[model samples]
Target: MTKQEKIDSFDPNGPASGNRIFGLPFSQKDAEIVILPVPWEVTVSYDAGTALGPEAILEASKQVDLYDPFVKDAWKMGIYMAKLDPKVIEKNRKYRDKAVAYLSAVEVGHEDETTDELLAKINKSCKKMVNWVQERTTELMNEGKRVILLGGDHSTPLGYLEALAKEHEFGILQIDAHADLRNAYEGFTYSHASIMFNALKIDNVKKLVQVGIRDYCEEEVEVIEASEGRVKTYFDRDLKHQQYAGATWKQQVDDIISQLPQKVYVSFDIDGLDPKLCPHTGTPVAGGFESEEVMYLFERLSESGKTIIGMDLNEVAPGPHDEWDANVGARLLYRMANLFGKNAGVVG
Candidate 1:
């Protein structure tokens, strides 16, 4: 069968018939883009639904239109899905239960006899999860595959970032509502809020360009300001001011692009979108960018000659009824494909 026909037969939202070709596949050697589903949401502070995020996104991805209008023929890039780690899921469940029990006890002004033990257990689980993800991501990078992590929460990408750092000295283009610059949050060393702090310590990360930062602790703000030029924040309020001052978003986007290094790693938190799109995300803030605005920002970055080395889309939690979060995530995945297609040197 022709290649286009194979791709056309596979609807991203529809059930995949055995013969239909879904997303991009790697070449004869192996898949070009390796998708690592890290089904972990243990350290999420405010919400509990992100553990199912990866599967929900994959299920919804089945319905995405494969023909990317931007770069064209992005499906040919050979996207390969890795096996979901059920062991990770099991560990995550245990951690979450422990955390919930501990938090519940604390909230009610009661002390559980096993409080200390449970907290210790949860921290251990988070460390193990990070090591596992780091191991998997490192293996894939050694194999010359660009990794796109399907996350359980924003914390899930820390290991991937660590792995990517080993090979590429790149800047982090962080798109998120929160600063994620806390040293450790809620007594968990690997909490979602600490990802950037961990990433900042990694030697290979050259710069951090954080966008959509509307929520952060005062200390976190001080850290960003004190970092000199190493950590640049285009705070959401500043973005609004730019628009209010008659700066077109296109120009602002270009300005955003200028702060980035030639090579970038996009850490996209779904909560960076307007909360309306992802109500279930762990800590949806009061204000953020529209999905299209974020997409355009990245698209402009791609067009301005920056290479997206690796990326992670995280914090997308599915609600009980609507699939809005996954839908947004799947489309973002397509946009990632378009960016990767442009950068990976794929021909249309």
Candidate 2:
């Protein structure tokens, strides 16, 4: 069927169909935006299950309403998420066990030859994951499709950033609870805790602006201080204090947006929101922005004339008995897809 015919036949408010993201009837070639699902989570420091985030979000996305007040007829933009690669999933499972053992040894201050070998293997596997993401994203970008990366963890974006660096120079606007600037949290070079550290190594990433950060270590603070304005952090405590002192969210959001460059890449970790919204996320923090609060920031970002070159949402792990995390992730994905489509001029 023609694209128009498919749209005409689609029931936006009806029950969601199975398989496709948002239950949309559009192939990769027909979609304006393509999402890469990275199902590797070998380095999560705390809980697991984020490797299943892409699949869970896909299932929950079927319930999201297509109408958006912010972007009219947003579903027409054609957002298609790539299927999860089974090879990557298998690698994640394999390295995750090794990572667990490595972490246990480190916690006990036991550094043996076996630990060294395990660490080496885990790092090698992670680098392979990065390479895989870069190759796929490069293909999608070359196809003239805007991309959204659905990740197993924050570390998943390093490869995506690498691919973007080859094409455009952009700054990252990171929304997360942790600083993610540790050199190597658990002796793993590509550990999730070291994502921002690895990201800074990219020449095309000019600046890093972080918000909703309430949990971090002294080393991360030192990294931020040492960045010499290259990194700007808006601590959650400070933002709350500002609000308590009569400063509106709009005022704070404007300040945050001012620190970003003209070209922006949004890195959203589910833990950036209040724990109530993502209790089962890989790492749950105490304080965070409301969903709409972050959404408003995105809207202001678009209105500020900054180009959102690319984006990724990570660290959403669903509960065994509940679908809350995936539900939120799916809705957030939908909103971001629409925002990206509108920014790219693919949606009216």
Candidate 3:
């Protein structure tokens, strides 16, 4: 059926019937937005389930209600996820075991030749994944599709950033609990913890504005200090302190957006949210924003007149029995996707 015909027959309030995202009926060609699901997670330092995130989120997305009060008729902004790459999946499963063994060895100071070999192999594959993402996204961009990357882990977006840097000089608005700035963290160049550090190497990326950073090491702080205003940090503690001093979130959000350039890329890690909302994420922190608070940030961002060049939502891991994490991820993705439409003047 054509997109209009599908729209005519579908019920927004009924049980989800198809495998399509949010039960929307548009195919990739019919939709204005495309979601690239990266299904590889090799260097997760704490948890192992995030490699399964794209499929989990895809399953959960079917159950989400399509109505949005903020972005009316946003369901018409079609979301089509590309087929998950099997090569990436195979490599993830193969390397994750080695990553686990290597991490365990590091914890006990038992690094050996085997661990070194594993590190080299994993790093090489991660580099390949990055290049794959850049190439695929470059093709999608060439087709005039607005792409949002749904990730295997935080490490998935380096190539997406590389693709964007070729044509646009944009700032990053990173929402996460960790600083993600450790250089070659744990000897893995593409470790999830090192995404932002590696991102800074891209000269076209002019600024990075980070928020909700409650957990980070001194080396990350040193990186920020050495960045010479290229990095702007809004620590979770300082934001709370300001709130306690009677500053409203609206005021704080304005301050945060002020640091960004005209063009922005949103990099959202589900762990940036309170752990209760995303308990199965790779690394859960003690304090973070509620879902609505983060949504409000996105909402305000849409109203700020800044162009959203691209976005990625990462680190959503599904539990064995509980669907709460993916459920939340699905709803968040729905909201975030609509805002993408709103920013681009294509929907809402």
Candidate 4:
């Protein structure tokens, strides 16, 4: 069926059908927004299952209702995820084993050529994954589709940012629990902890506005300070203090939004939400916004009329037995994608 034919016959209230994302029957060629799932987590440094995030979110996304209150009948906009690349997954598992072994040796104060070899392999493979993501992202962008990345870790979006930087000068609105500002964290060039540090290196990325940052080291703090206002942080503690002092959430969110430029990229790490909401995430932080609070923030962002250049959601590691994390990730992904669509004028 043609796009319109499928939409005309589809029932928003029915169960998801046809195996497509959110059960929408749209192919890559037909979609206005394309989701690229990156199944790589070689530099997690802590928990490991974030490599499973994309597929887990895909499975749990079947539970998301088609209707988004923020954008009426938004499912018609043709949202789709390309098939997860098997080669990427295979490489991730291979390098992740090396990372684990290397980190274990480092923990014991054992440094050897073998450990160095493992570290070298992991870093090279990680760079390959980033390049892989960048190539695909550029291809999709050339097709006139808005790309939304579903990531294995915060590090995964660096490639997406690279692709965008070539053509657009934009600021980042980063919703993350940590600053991710470590330079070559843990000696891994593309560590998840070093994502923002890598991102700022891109000349087209003019600024970074970070929110929900409740976790960071002195190194990251120093990075932010050295940025000389290029990097703005709204710590979770400070936001809480503002509320304790009788300021409204709207007022705080407005200030956060003000830090951004007219064109923006949204990078949401699941741990940015309360740990209870993303307990299985790679590195769960203690404090975060309620689901509704963040959702409301996204709503206000769309209202602000900043052109959403791209988006990414990452760090949603699902537990072995509990689907709660993926379930939450799926719904949030849906809402966030809709917000992007609404701003891009692809969804009403």
Candidate 5:
């Protein structure tokens, strides 16, 4: 059988043993790509089940067409998929259950030991998750591989972000429905709501430019205001108003890009797209970037000579029957791989 047929025979859940679209052994070095599946969704405030996102994306990736119109020969870059760590899965479940209970309660800051204990458990587990990811990312970087992290949620990239920080000072191009600037949401230090806030804490993060922000609290606004120019937000409200008044999205994209630094790390939460593509994502805001616009944004970034050091496409969930989000995510990942390949001079 051919390589594709061999991979088709390896899927444990499917009819065969190695039916993965990308094939088995999951290790590809020539492509200069390391795909880390972080099966974490514990700190997700609104919805559950993102813990199942990475595997679903992987399964759906089998159906992804290798030909990318924008970046030719992107598939030649070896795409390496790392197996999901079982300990992270166990930790994610424990924290997910704890978060559900914590969020369901009336009094949030109840000075009780149970709350404290749960908080401790979640934080400790998250630290372990972050540290392991950091170590893995650093190892990959040292091996001269570009990394694309598949997330359990937005927060899954924190460790990888730290790893990137050590090597280069880069800016963040965050695409999400929410600002994710909350210091700590519902007493969860590593909450999805605080991903950007944590990034802001990193000294190496030059600037954080967030787009598609439509959900946030008064507290989050205050924090953004305090951040000054360090965090530049392109609010959906304002962007829509601009579009309503005849300003094109391209103009808006230009405005957003003006605030970024030279080197960029794209943090693309699938929720940043219209809800139709990802109805089951952790949080679904009313307004978001259309997939086309996001693609254009990446294209523009690439054309502008800004090196995309690393990126994460997270919070993509598979629906009951549809594989739309992963379908989109797989394409995004391929596009990003091409972009990284070009930046690293791997793809000519």
Candidate 6:
């Protein structure tokens, strides 16, 4: 069947088939939005399992209903996720074991030649992963397809950001629990904790606006302060205080949206949401936004006339015997895809 026939015949409320993202029937060539899955999470400091996030989300996405009230007939816009590379997954396991040992040694103040060698190897592997992602994303962009990066960790988007920088000058809207500003965190250059710091090095990233940040180190604070308006952070505590002082969420959202450039790239770490929504994420911090709150903000962003050039959803680890985290991630992914498609004029 042609793409239109598949869309017209597919039941929005029916069971999702195996083998495709959100159980959609479209292939890569016909899909308006293409998602690249990066299943590598070697530098995560807190938890393990995020390397499995892409598969988990793919499984959970099958349960998602295609009908979206926010964007009418959102499923009409073809969305397809590329297959995850098994080689990357194997690489993640290899380096993750090394990273675990290296972090263990560091925790006990055991800094020795063996640890240094392991760290160097892990860093080199991470650089290769970045390059792999960059090449894939660049290829997709060259095809004139809007991309959404499905990630293994917060660090997964670094290469996607690099690929985007080559084509567009845009600001980043980071929704996360931490500042992710550590330089060479735990001796790993591409540590998940240093994504924003690495992102800042890109010449085309004009600004970075972070929200729902409740956990960060003094060093990260220094970087945010030092940026001199290049980086704008809305700490979770201050936002709560503002709400307590009678400021509406809509008002705060407006204020947050006002800081972004006309073109924006959304980097969403699942830990940015309340822990109840993502209990398995790597770093679970207290006091975060509700799912609807963040969705409302995204809706506002869409209505504000800002173009969502690209996006990524990251750090969504699944719990053993439970699919809650992936379920949330899948729904959020659908929402983000719909919003990006609508903004790009591909979906109505």
Query: What is the C-alpha local distance difference test score of each model?
Result: 0.81, 0.93, 0.91, 0.92, 0.80, 0.93
Q: What tens-digit string does per-residue lDDT give for candidate 5 at 1-348? A: 544553454342333125443543335454368888899988887777677888887787766666667766555555777778898888888778877776666265555777778778878878888898899889888888888998888889999999999989999999999988888787778888899999888999989998988988898889789887888888888888999999998888887877778899999998888898788898887878778889888877877777889989899877777877777777677677677776666764
Better of 2 and 5 by lDDT: 2
TM-scores of the models, in the given order?
0.91, 0.98, 0.97, 0.98, 0.90, 0.98
lDDT of 3 by residue, 1-348 (tens): 888887788778888877888777788888888899998789988877888888998899888888899998888767787888898899888888888888888899988888788789888988999999999999998988899999889999999999999999999999999999999998999999999999999998999999999999999999999999999999999999999999999999989999999999999999999999999999999999999999998899989999999999999999999888999998998888999999999899
Give per-residue CA lDDT, model 2, range 1-348, as digits (tens): 878888999999898896899989988998999999999889999999899999999999998989999999989979899988999999999999999999999899998998999999999999999999999999999999999999899999999899999978889999999999999787889989999999999988999999999999999999999999999999999999988999999999999999999899999999999999999999898989899999999988977989999999999999999999999999999999999989888896
Tens digit of per-residue lDDT, candidate 6, span 1-348: 889999988888899986899999998998999999998889988878888889999999999998888898888889999998989989999999999999999999999998889999999999999999899999999998999999898888888899999888999999999999999898999999999999999989999999999999999999999999999999999999999999999999999999999999999998999999999999898779899999999989988999898999999999998999999999999999999888888887
Q: Cα lDDT for residue 320, model 1?
A: 89
Candidate 2 stretches greater than 4 Å from native: none
Question: Which stretches of candidate 1 lie above 4 Å from their native place?
Answer: 1-30, 108-114
lDDT of 1 by residue, 257-325 (tens): 899888899899989888998898889988898999998988887778788888888888998898888
TM-score computed on alpha carbons, candidate 3 = 0.97
Model 4 ranges off by over 4 Å: none
> What clash count goes with each model?
12, 0, 0, 0, 13, 0
- Clash pairs (backbone) in predicted model 6: none
> What C-alpha RMSD separates each model from the true structure?
2.9, 0.9, 1.2, 0.9, 4.0, 1.0
TM-score of candidate 6 against the unseen true structure: 0.98
The parts of candidate 6 lying over 4 Å away from their true place are none
